[model samples]
Target chain A: MNFTRRFTLAGLLAVLLPVSATVAQVDSLPSWNSGSARQAIVDFVGRVTREGNPDFVPVPERIAVFDNDGTLWCEQPEYFQAAFALDSVKAMAPKHPEWKQQEPFKSFLAGDRTALAEQGEQALLTLVTAAHSGKPTDEFSKSVADWFSTARHPRFNRPYNELVYQPMVELLAYLRVSGFKTFIVSGGGVEFMRVWAEKAYGIPPEQVVGSSGVTQYQLDAAGKPSLLKTAKVQFIDDGPGKPSGINMMIGRRPILAFGNSDGDHQMLQWTMAGSGARFAGLVHHTDEVREYAYDRQSKVGKLDEAWDEARAKGWTIVDMKQDWKTIFREKP
Target chain B: MNFTRRFTLAGLLAVLLPVSATVAQVDSLPSWNSGSARQAIVDFVGRVTREGNPDFVPVPERIAVFDNDGTLWCEQPEYFQAAFALDSVKAMAPKHPEWKQQEPFKSFLAGDRTALAEQGEQALLTLVTAAHSGKPTDEFSKSVADWFSTARHPRFNRPYNELVYQPMVELLAYLRVSGFKTFIVSGGGVEFMRVWAEKAYGIPPEQVVGSSGVTQYQLDAAGKPSLLKTAKVQFIDDGPGKPSGINMMIGRRPILAFGNSDGDHQMLQWTMAGSGARFAGLVHHTDEVREYAYDRQSKVGKLDEAWDEARAKGWTIVDMKQDWKTIFREKP
Candidate 1:
């Protein structure tokens, strides 16, 4: 109480400061409400970093993996990637005249949402593969960057990247500063995510693990080397593919894992199965006003098996509406 | 001359000190003999790291890749991985009497080098898969560790890892200290290199890109997960595969690349193809006494086309006998 009284003048000074506009700006995870969800993360990072503590994890071994689509950002309407794929078909439609008359592409181009949804994920995959295959990697990366620069979410009316949850962004920074290496493990295309991951989440291209397209490297006589992407899928990086992706790319079990859907079930399981103190968390999309509410019934970012398992195992289940002080970084 | 005279007393005291006995202690690449080869490396590093230099590269883009087999450690007589595979076959020989009657295994077990050589790499691969596959990843890593603990190089009579090229090891350390991310891009089994890379070369498992076996992840009824190694081959990571592996695993072009054989030819080419400051060097084995001398004519680590290409492209060619002040980090 004395300390509080002594800081009264300083608190007023803080309020007067322009940059220190909000409580979130003054502390770690300021975007997160002071609840068990936030406390669990703080406690886990603290326990692992506390030297001489029995559960202390070395800096090299402190790996925290995140599921990108729903856990880190909004995955409503469609996976941002699926949206990219849909938009790509529209962009490439001028070049591919046949696509104007094609089944999935036709329905997709007609903006027939119900018909496109009925066409299912396979139809979307076919269109995605057709839209972005057989191009050099640099060209693909350029187009993805171009898309990100202009692409906006219909619901939020904000750039897709700016739609990343404010709390999770703060969480990633907090973890990184605590000596934890953060990685994005997603079902999205690796090439697509590598373009914007660095600027968006402070995660470098090398630290991103995701689904891949079969890419071939060809060196021309003029000494120009191009890594060309093909239509074939290399690794899915979803469902059971998550653990396999972690093994192939990361090569070690992560200490902490977070996700919002069943697609991340294996990754969370693998992280929790490791020996020593571990943290596994699920971001429950419970706020319909702030973000789309979905669970077992959702077609995209389904959260059923993982929701049950997380509860059964005592993993942190964050109710978005309750646990976060803010949702998207965008102002309401 | 005046500075030398001023430091005369200090130089004498440095000579009295064990670690500081060499003038090399006062600088980087001490184990590298002062010559054009050493100068090339030093100059390249200096130019890239110098702020505002025309050839300067950013720290995140300062990627340096090294092939493992002969570039870092001795790979003569046979690759260290080949030796491990042979030893693994013997260790597992008692498990099945059928192996005693198999062609390559029979010849290998009987120490018939001539017959085994005729059987070739394919036969050795068969034996290696039989000896190592179907076990869990952790179990395989444990076996590799166990072997490294006891196995000694036949010629050096020292641990295989101890036979690392001291100059190269120092270079790796120097590069890391210079804010460069160092990676092992090798044709060796990723699993085998991962077990010893950290302790021997300060490289982590995730930084190693190599040939791998198809691994399967399974979760048991008791909620136990196991990453099982299958006999199936995944990626070979040799020759042109090097570039593809780099694209798949690293997702970016390296600025610096080093290798000792034709297998690393594509990796070097790919690195050199990247825009702006880049370096590609080949270590030509020429020290028969301290290490195995090999190039062009050798069956293993053949350096014919790459040697010619390196010479034409102005890539640095390191003559092991002349370039390095120390070979095995072992004193005679």
Candidate 2:
């Protein structure tokens, strides 16, 4: 769908969903099974949003931050953004023949996941910059939008937009209906996520906060002003950086935070720390039949420290196997 | 007013003004005289917000950014934030008695504005850090709020909040009612501005983007989490930084930008460069009798470059002497 059509559909969804939530209370989060995890979310939102309740939060203070990779959508096999980076590297290989001989790029091109993984953090950074940088921001956005429209996951053979969890989408809509302004505080490149986030999640580009590289404002040869993406890293919104990024971008501390890994640890910690009513949740990938289930020792979306902390902190742990009745959002 | 009371007033204003704007078409901005400058604002807002107009922007796309100091309120004598910093330095002098002999602080403490100005940028930085750092975010917020509640402008002998330009406050409210989301992209400390921006201007803390120092998340001995404001400057949201800050925080180009002085040049340039119904305006401090009028050669809020650019680029130049019927907001 074009931008206009997608925007129109979003408008329709935004209008229809709130009415449904108010009228059809039982099915506000229909994709989720009736469980402790779902109950926690409903109760927290209810207490904070109900007028005259001691725990009621004012509308402006109702901030909800979410992680993108595993919490909102599928991240296993590999992170969706990392997969896009790898694909981009291959597409540009013909122009930069040296990439075939370059250390990590060579292994990446040869489909040697283990070799690329062994090359470590620097190699991943190189791949990300190579894929994302050296374009005007508008062009970069268009590239990401185009990729999302065309690219399909190897396992599911569905577009990445289609891979978003249905329950979480409902939760996002539900939260907004409850007067919570939802924000995506993600480790993924902000430009990449911004292209499709609004269309897929009902979250607008302005509300999506994520990692970004340095962007230079310039007037190109034609005297047309543009913001060019540079290789220099500006911020990395992950782990401890999540809370810091949230503070910098959003200014206000969130009351509700959702994530699925150690990357989201500090975000939840920061949210829970704020005075008054708060809620934090983690989506535990436990349903291998419906979705990939790798967490503790996984290369991507590792869930260790946060998992233990969530249990101890009384954070709702959404067991994918038990809490969610559906994974990928079914096509309309 | 307390935050709750301020919020209630804002809610009331938000409801009443939109109805008034639609019905009372003769004077949407009562403080602004009927002139070319006022006409420009009315025309731009009408074109962009009118349904089915080609230039009509979507409500979400109607992002409007404003500079806080001179644009929104009086910045004469010194920026109000700087005055607060100076007061903070004086307030904390007992504990840090050594500041009596310290270079900038010594000059600052001696009440020698000339000597402090001679010390230049470094002295200003030292003062800001000394005033703002070494406290929890909430504590810092309380300090600012406390100061704003009591601190009076020397000339006006009224609280600084009352010195906000009546016309601009009306403009902010009018824009919001017209489906434009207003944001403050100021050069002042984000924490300082955020403490009272919402209460003072009806712009929320989340919508106020500004310069910031590094903040650290910590848990105290009692296991209470707090964000500590450190002394290191993170980003300066002025001049070239304004556009960058807007991009990072709002993640979208603003359709309209209001600013004053050379600091706002880039922000206006970036806003006007966007491919849409865009508007940029500079508030010229020409009302010397009502308010201090200094521009090109002034020490504070020098407006040489932006003044010239506004004319050349066809950006609206808000001549305060000519445009406004009233300056400071009158107390009820």
Candidate 3:
């Protein structure tokens, strides 16, 4: 063949190459540095998705459950949902005048973290219930959506949605392209997460399994049906509850599970225990310069037990400092 | 044009036509007689699916929920789940000899419907809980699946899975083809229904929302995580709870809802009350020959309030005897 003909053929091949081939050619996990952690994920997905392979999983059974907080986004300093709840409390303080003098409320309003923590879990729960409930479900969802659109992360000074991990976002999209259905199973409030999960993680509200409060079906004065938010705590989707939540909500065993803390240990264990090819991964937030670094002793997203378990079980532990070339999403 | 050319053009048109157009040209609802009820469904689906139209709803919002028992299948003898529970109680009778003397269990096992009914809801619940719980969730699912495969309906002498309404099955597929996500929202055990709903109704386990007992995550002696069934009663996805269950499970308001009894009244109400074009339908069991007929006076699947509401609200009421060309699915 002539040189011009060869060059024309090569140009056509480059243009016509499949997206998967293109992705593979250019680092599939661009935000993730070339490391063992990235390689492990790629290998697991390839094995499970390869047709006629022993590890081949049917498209319907390719379920991947991801923890929302530290795994998908930055949960450092304080959980983003907790911040939303605190902001909501401040917003509603004018209506509930008694909160000005209430035990947990006073400490919470004054930003006295130590005093609020000393008051215990029940007190904290009381403040959460007060701040989050006693409104229509749609109204709560609207408020959450509005908060996400405007609310900025304290440290980064960017919209909370923009603070999501770039590597994890790519992982979610990559799994989806491989015909896996990705879900967010978190310890965070289910309703709160549902508002932004679709836009943030490409997960629909129905695919989200998380902590939830009791909701009652009611009709307004005009007889329009509405789900009213009640103060009653329903299920806490954390720790052992993670698996139970997946069972109750998803009704299928996930093939892959990802999270960052002890709360997701059972979820990962559950995923790994299922028959056929499975994967369990943990994100170790070790990028102190780029992101807050804490493990084994951190108050927020403590990773001691899961860290040891991941190592013992040979599960993938993503070191943010070394494994990830980038942390938060880049501005468009 | 020449006759040969015209014939060839006609053949090409037939080959290129959509399945829906082909269905309409022949019979869209084969089991459903030409009637208002069938027309309503066709109209609603058509209006919402038509692109560039004012009534068009995006595919994501096309949620359709159906009641399981009397609506999807014949619930005449009893709810198939109830019969399964009774059989289960009898199967476990040797281990629990005390059940022979218990009020509900004794009546239930002896096949005394009147005596069991008089014993009240609490007694019935005890029998259900005893029959269903105290095993791992996967094991229970396996047992239920095995039962569905082997167990025959008392009167029909056919496997229970084969007893689903032919008209409804077609409707499910028809709606799905038009971008509707079909779901089975039942008052039966979620785990039990999850076993067969997919095979019987083409709805996946994830889309089946129903009454459930509490489940816990447990690591067995092998240290493998499993969801263990607990005897504690969680939520009953019936009556008003149907709407709440739909809200919590689906996270999206259904555009169309179908049911046959009072238990589904609120579900229909909720679906109808949602903004945008909506359709609510009830299957009236008016055929005594092909399938057993019972409505307001029936012990199981009482259709009193919903019947009245259907008339009052001008919702579609399917007269099973007149509307359906056939009832149960024809054997291959």
Number of the top-ranking candidate, with lDDT as the measure:
2
Clashes of 1: 0
TM of each candidate vs. truth:
0.89, 0.91, 0.91
Could you tell me which residue pairs clash in candidate 3? none
Residues B1-332, candidate 1: write the lDDT tens digits: 13344346533343233211222345768888888888899888877876667997877898899998889988988888878887888888888688678898889889998998898878887877776688888999999999888998888788888888889988997787666899999998888888889878898878988888777889889989888888987677888888878877887889999999999988999899889989999999998987878798998899998999999989998899999989876642
Worst lDDT window (10 residues) for model 2 chain A?
A14-23
Candidate 2 lDDT tens digits, B161-276: 78888999999988887778999999988888887788778998778899987788787797676778888777888887887788777889999999999999889988988897
Question: What is the fnat value (0 to 1) for candidate 2?
Answer: 0.37
Q: Comparing 1 and 2 by DockQ, which wins?
A: 2
Span of 10 residues, lowest total lDDT, candidate 3 chain A:
A10-19
Q: State candidate 2's DockQ.
A: 0.37
State the displacement of the C-alpha of residue A63, model 2, in Å, after optimal TM-score superposition.
Answer: 1.4
lDDT of 3 by residue, A1-332 (tens): 12353245433333344323434554557898888999899998878876667998877789999999899999979888888888898888889889778888888888898998898988877877876799988899998988888889888899888889999999998887666889999999988888888888888878888888788988779778888889987778999989888888889899999999998988999888878889999999888899989988998999988889899989999999999888988986
Output the worst ten-in-a-row residue range by lDDT, candidate 3 chain B: B1-10
Interface RMSD of 2: 6.4
Task: State the iRMSD of every prediction, in order shown.
Answer: 12.4, 6.4, 10.1
lDDT of 1 by residue, A1-332 (tens): 12344246434333233211223244778888888998898888777876567888877899999999999989988889878887887888888788678888888888888988898878877988976688988898898888988998998888888888889988997777666789999998888888888878899888999888777878778878787888977778888788878887788899999999999998999899999999999999989998878999998889999999998889999999999888987553
Cα-based lDDT at residue B123, candidate 3:
80
B1-332, model 3: which lDDT tens digit per residue? 12353245433333344423533554446788888988888888777876556788877789999999999988869788877887788878889788778778788878898998798888877887887888899889888877777889988999888999999999997787666889999998888888888888889878889888888877779887777788987778999889888877788889999999999999999999888899999999988898988889999999998899899989999999999998998885
